[model samples]
Target: MAGDKELAGFILFLSQFPFLQAAKILTISFIGGSHYLLMDEISRILHDNGHQVRMFRQFGDGMLPGRQAQQSPYPVSTYSLGEKYLAEYKALFTEAQKDNLMGRDSLQNFLIFLNELSHQCNVTLHQSDILNFLKEEKYDLAVIDGFNPCCFLAAEKLGVPYIAMFPGTFMNAAKVGVTGPLSYVPIFQSLLTDRMDFLGRLKNTFMYLGSHIVDKKMDALFQKVIDEHFPLGSRPSIADLHLRAELWIYNIDFSIEFPRPLLPNIQCIGALLAKPAKPVTQELEDFIAESGDSGFIVVTLGSMISSLPLVEFLKEMIDGFAKIPQKVIWRYKRSEWPQGVNVAHNVRLMDWVPQNDLLGHPKARLLVTHGGLNSLMEAVYHGVPVVGIPLFGDQYENMVRVKAKNMGTFIPPDEMKAEKFASTIREVVENGCYKTSAMKQSVILRSRPFPPDQQLLGWVEHIIQSGGGGHLRPYSYQQPWYQQFLLDVILFLSACVAAIIYLILRVIRALIYFISNRKQKQN
Candidate 1:
């Protein structure tokens, strides 16, 4: 309580700047339930601060994560990517569950989805309704999804300075711009730690470089869209537009991530966007209360991948849960649920459950998750141990940190057996180390000097007040890529060494000719 009060006082002190005034803000988020949730939170904060806030996102029947689209507070404009790509989206995750996410087949499926998403975004940005509204409204600032290059292009067209918001610790082609030192920083899905021996560092470097190569197709697709729209003037490439954002707010913080240097423009607001767990219903409360001394466990794969029906995996989970005395709640789509797996009396299945709230419940013993950043953050905030079954994109890497910190353990879905999966759950539940480490880490997470909301509003206003990040923007951004990488310095050094070598060769040839003439005269 004292720390929170002190932090509030500090924020009040910083709020005295003259430039702090209300402005019109435009926010955009396309696809993904978690993505929209982060954007919704930022929009709400800005709106509460006396700013005119409007949001743009995709909406279909039953799309938004926890609520209907009508319930949103902001003035929202929803677009549809149409049903054509919907099947493709489902198929992408289908292939992901069948093959390892790191495999060639799965990557190709993901790339196809990226291309489809890019094309859809291009249509949305150019549509008569969305573009005309954006042009006329002339928002003071645009808060855009960092993954969507089209949003950056839209904000640029409207002549609005914008900030980038990421749902997780940065991934995708945009990472190419902000990649830190390769010696220590691990790429998403690499599963490498910051601490590395020579062999590990070598592997890390390859994975980092290889990720860029694989993402070039997606980058090219985005570039094609950007070029068509912004071709009239001095056009910056898509990479340049990413670095030009006034600020970047990431959904990850230092406690869970490996140590790495970051630019001044980047901020870690982590769980600040996460809403406190709402109260569970009395019926659900009764169910949990009935579990007695042994608490229940919660299972969710997050909003995106939760619907996948992995036949054997589901059976293994069901069989494993049957052996445990603790009650279990599994959030899964009933339409997709396999008939083969027999649900035990101790287990209940719901199409949607309040995951964050359930994790916060005192009777909640553990979390079985896909390791999405949002799920992980909730678990950490509530101090619940995890059993990770990572599916795709950063899940593996996220779980690696979970294992390293002793907060949880993970089983790759392919290697998962009924007995092994059950035992892993039992281990996390019975072992005191997992719970103890989780509580200690929770202290570190909650102990940051500034309250997350204050930190968020402070930096957001700072960027706007200073006229777009001011000196916070790195000088390296202004330099050409060659200069940034020190290639120019290397070229100069190479030329100097070559000139010295040439001179030395000439001197040796001249001496040899002189010696031969002397020998001829002596003869």
Candidate 2:
């Protein structure tokens, strides 16, 4: 790792600059897709901070929250993932889903494809495009998601500080010596198992290792790309490429995800959504009020997990809704259900419902969710118990945390039997434990008086004023390969070999002398 690039980023120092003048903060944030609502919240926070924010969002054609529709986030932007890219990425995801890469072995293969694709976007194609744009229209700072290292590449080349922010409970950042909450999820411990079984633990260990491999491979791929583009007689090493920024902003509150060792570079502003938007509709309230004795349940899956994909399974959910006495308000894709399933007088389904609003309603009882971070936060915010039906990726682990907190039940999609699903929802709604747990979480969320948006702004300003994060920039000694320590083992073995050789030589000389003495005696 000689001549490796120093990763930029440290705690944003707040003291030096005059507070009178406005600062320009150019932001680029997208990790594969804009389907994540969490990005919107981050965008919102930056805008509230009075920073001039420019964005680059992928996978969606819609206008960014702060910008005009005519001129989008990027310099020359096309929301379309070209037909060839689409066909290939779809094929890859399809194969992964079919193979159930969540199982052992195939997981690494799936991860490699994902990382390579992400690298192509962040490092190769997207990185230079943004840099050229920045060169013409320069901005002070860039903030983006941590996993998307390519965005940071441009920031490094431009000599600007960029912050890498992780959305949810990501594990490897801690292992990489970054400050954050590592997913404390037990290995493969799904809905039924309290802890990970043997195969599950093995799978977890491999995934943990696999992520690092993916990171290494990503760095290699980016380095190759950079070398190809510039070819500057000699190239910058890949480590020289992936550096941390002047500051790190974690969109999480310490009150909830607690016990983290605070690092100056890493800032937590998670509770920005604590003063959430008010419910837009009042008609939705009338329906909830009607669900009298038993109360109502809310069903919602996050943005990425499509309601279209689960349409068939939803038929069974419709059937389950008929059996329960409590009313159900499902945030669905289509405005109406198929003809026959609409028979239940207790159920009201809409293509879209204001979810947080419905959950806050007094009649709201239990929640059926896909367990995305936003939904998780809302549920915790309202103190509503969840029956999580995790679809993919981090959802399973997110739900596991919910259950551990005594605030939810989880049923993996594979194990979602119709009767079992309904029964579990009924048990959670009727029983006292789930609600009690939700109330407890709600208290924790509400206990903190201050909103996090201001704190986020303060930190960003700190970075600008500090002349790059000098405080958080680590000294060089922290770098080492995992096997480098094993070199001592090599030295110890070499010493043993040398000792054996010395003994052999001594014995040979001694025997030669003894023979000479015997010969002399004979003479």
Candidate 3:
């Protein structure tokens, strides 16, 4: 019943349907947290659909392997975890942390890390060593990441169909002449429903295998893919990734993000996380009661953007809430408060918090965020307004959605001053538009016929019933990116330009020499 509703909602809004079937798919990812989430979902969908699935995931806990890949071809397969890649992963992080040429500014550090991550991603995916693990299996379609385009090569070498699956928030999926972006919204999808404050959540970490801990460990496993295929060209460039696919499947849906550019081959799958049988926990109810009117706000910068690095920013935010009678619960990583900033009387801090639960809570009046897609969706799900402070990656673009819907205000990372922070919070609180838009978003979410998970699973089954995702194949994969970009002729033009410049320089030199020789003869 729930599934039907999800599909109904999606069908109502799906401006267009994508050609999303595949047979004998080589699904791959480095196994980082979000990436793993996307890849796993893809594998599950493909597998459930009755298609032959070959998964090359780097971050298999003890259940997945590193070197030798296990193959099932169809009915079943076991992807075991391995620790062979840990030392190298730690080394990379150590090197990355050590290479932190950027001082304490977390924002710059994030940018630099993003650059390094791009470079590193290219290095790991292209390793010849992984080819040894490729079973005697054939893939009809392929899925690759924009960050690591090496899968294009993998698909070409394997002679199969290819598609790009982006778990991260990106906008290239909506570029010119395509029609897929209409349904894509970047967000994380999880089934666990629990409510715990920052500290209580941290306190709960050891009790159960928390997603946070699992993700960190998973990132290590995924890092190996980079270790195997890196340092493309003498100089590092993500351009080296150059892996192409027949279609690109984005782990985002369009209901949350409207006005997206239309594109072909790029499909929206953001609502992939919405699953049936999701249960709520008690810890959630207590937190909402604690807020006691004036409604508290949930402030999180996400895991990638640290609260410690944004100490001054956090201080300003806390100060802003202090002026108002509302409560402010910040997901602060640090144990102690720094000087020059007083923790607001109604504020609480912890290393991590149960975000989904907190967002659902009635007290979650407004959300102050770095505009990570996952958080944005959670806020949208509960109809809570947002105050976006986008930092990097998709955050900037995602915030545009926040502003477009009149959902809330967006404060750039640099413009986030104490005074502005206070005023923005007040405005979001006092203003009717923000809440009205939030409620509209909530209606949009609830309006969907099926939850996200059902839509995702139904599509998976749709592919399987059809037999090996042959229907999903593109007309052809003959055009390379160079051909697509016209770089071949551009290279020829560059050479021509160089030759002309050389010839012109030679003529100028000859003229000068002739003039000198003539003057000497005259003398």
The runs of at least 3 residues in candidate 3 whose Cα sits more than 4 Å from the true structure, single-residue gaps closed, are 1-27, 31-33, 40-115, 122-131, 134-143, 150-160, 168-170, 174-244, 260-264, 274-284, 334-342, 458-523
Candidate 2's residue-wise lDDT over 1-523, tens digit each?
Answer: 3334322222234344366356656555544432234555665667665666666555432222222234233233224455576567656654554333123324466456656555455434544564676666666777766655556555555556676666665443533355322243333222322355667656656665556665566566565556554448645544543335566666554333534465566666664554554764677767767778778998876543323334345666677777888888876545334544453577775655567777787778888887766677777888889998775556666786787778888876656566887898888887898889888988887676555666676677777777677678564214564343466678888899999999999999999999999999999
lDDT of 1 at 10: 91
* TM-score of structure candidate 3: 0.60
Q: Which residue pairs in model 1 clash with each other?
A: none
User: Which scores greater on TM-score, model 2 or model 3?
Assistant: 2
The 10-residue segment of model 1 with minimum total lDDT is 61-70
Instruction: Count steric clashes of candidate 3.
Output: 48
Off by over 4 Å in 1: 1-19, 65-70, 83-105, 172-176, 232-236, 275-278, 501-523
Shift of residue 282 alpha carbon in model 1, Å = 1.6
TM-scores of the candidates are: 0.89, 0.74, 0.60
Better candidate by lDDT, 1 or 3: 1
What lDDT score goes with residue 223 in model 1?
73
